[model samples]
Target: MHFQWYPGHMTKAKRMMQENIKLIDLVIELVDARIPVSSRNPDIDELGKNKARLILLNKSDLAEEKQNDAWAEYFKEKGFSVVKVNSKRGGGIKSIQGVIQEACKEKIERDRKRGILNRPVRAMVVGIPNVGKSTFINALAGKACAKTGNKPGVTKGKQWIRLNKNVELLDTPGILWPKFEDQTVGLRLAFIGSIKDEILNTEELAMEMITFLTEKYPGVLEEKYSIEISEDSYECLRRIAESRHCLVKGNELDTNKAAILLIDDFRSGKLGRITLEFPEDYE
Candidate 1:
């Protein structure tokens, strides 16, 4: 689910979003719970303006509970209905229906005043690739009696999954591109495996992760790899290499192999529930 963004892809995605956004009354945004801010596309705010907004903190199972609460509050402060969810195991998903109604309350009230009645809230799921968009959709729309739709000669249009009497979701999730202009954003996305590894130096990336963990999530390296934290990130990496037996021929520690191992561990949640950025830290 790694994404490589190009200008052409960006343009096409934007076009599709514009087209689809018109068909929905609510925008359900999914962001990785660990790197909530960095995993977002700023363009969504502009495109989704005037729509009922709900931010679902996806992958909550892999993020610190305190951080997840803080993130929900952060989005709530910005006027979005927020829900912390772990799409992988269906955690917090049952509450989604209630939250969606709350988010679109104003819209429903307005419709009522205009004599509109019983209209279901139309919503769509959107996020950067590999942020578990598909998993969230499947989890929300599990095996049930569902309906399909088709427009004559219109490329077999979208099917709305009726979640209940008051909500219908778009079948396809919108894919948004990450902010590539910022080096830090790119690095964070890379660390989460949202971007291609070929474009990055694994050793350098691992060092950056080591530096972040030691400073912000203090003791993570020590607890997981049994390595003493050092002022030098490279030294910590070497310790991990030794503990993990990431050695080259002749039994010498292979720093490159160790870098890959460290990155994999962090991405796979082996390091622990971690949030790369925090609201206070950004402030």
Candidate 2:
């Protein structure tokens, strides 16, 4: 299946990020834990160069634990201060303050040397859509933190959410677009709902998802759908149609409907916490 991306919106998002990056001291990047590499748009590295980087593996609860550890180590090796977090449930949220301080330690040290003291670390959350950036900001800042409105010298209408005495976050997150030049990366993004559904056939995508699950997860489909696992993805899809009673008319199995159901289940974490690609799988 093929996926189409709008270059126009991407260009706009890049421009916005470039403008916003200049106003912050640290970039708190969020990546979908299930597809860490695929969900990320590497353009942020170029746009946020020289900024203190902290990568939050958001939705870590929906990913395999061992893979989460590997991804943390993977980004850490690339020089990002990485943290695993389940923003929805607040797991791993407490560690963020400490991690953020550590991630910006260099900046804080420089501030001290230059005789600048007690200046809060300014941060901005950035991520591709649906990677849980909004949820993360809310989780980090809570509801009680008031918006520090535009100041005299700062840009008008840019709100700063004071997370604490030592840290303040930009109220708006810097949006980034996922790179789609690589077909494999596009496919991975499509698999995770980062790409639009209209661009790809649901049945083909579900079959591909089943193929991957059968190979990597082993028996997830069988256990979830109560159907025999088959090496042929189409056959497995047919079994899902039969088990779920997905029918078009008069007992005719509706494989398309079943495919949509399977994909929906996978996306919503119903099929379980499944990570499509591992950090080791990255080039």
Q: Please tell me which predicted candidate would have the highest lDDT against the true structure.
A: 2
For residues 23-105, could you state the per-residue lDDT of candidate 2 as single tens digits?
Answer: 78999889999988888888988988999999999988888889899898999999999999999999989999999899899
TM-score of 1: 0.92
> Each candidate's TM vs. the true structure?
0.92, 0.95
lDDT of 1 at 225: 89
- Error (Å) of candidate 1 at residue 80 is 0.6
| C-alpha RMSD in Å of predicted model 2 compared with the true structure | 1.4
Which pairs in model 1 have colliding backbones? none
Residue-wise C-alpha lDDT for candidate 1, range 144-230, written one tens digit per residue: 627546534324556778877798888774477876666777778888888778877888899999988988899889989898888
Question: lDDT for model 1, on a 0 to 1 scale?
Answer: 0.85
Candidate 1: segments with Cα more than 4 A from true spot: 1-7, 151-156
Window of ten residues with lowest summed lDDT in model 2: 171-180
Q: What is the lDDT of residue 262 in candidate 2?
A: 96
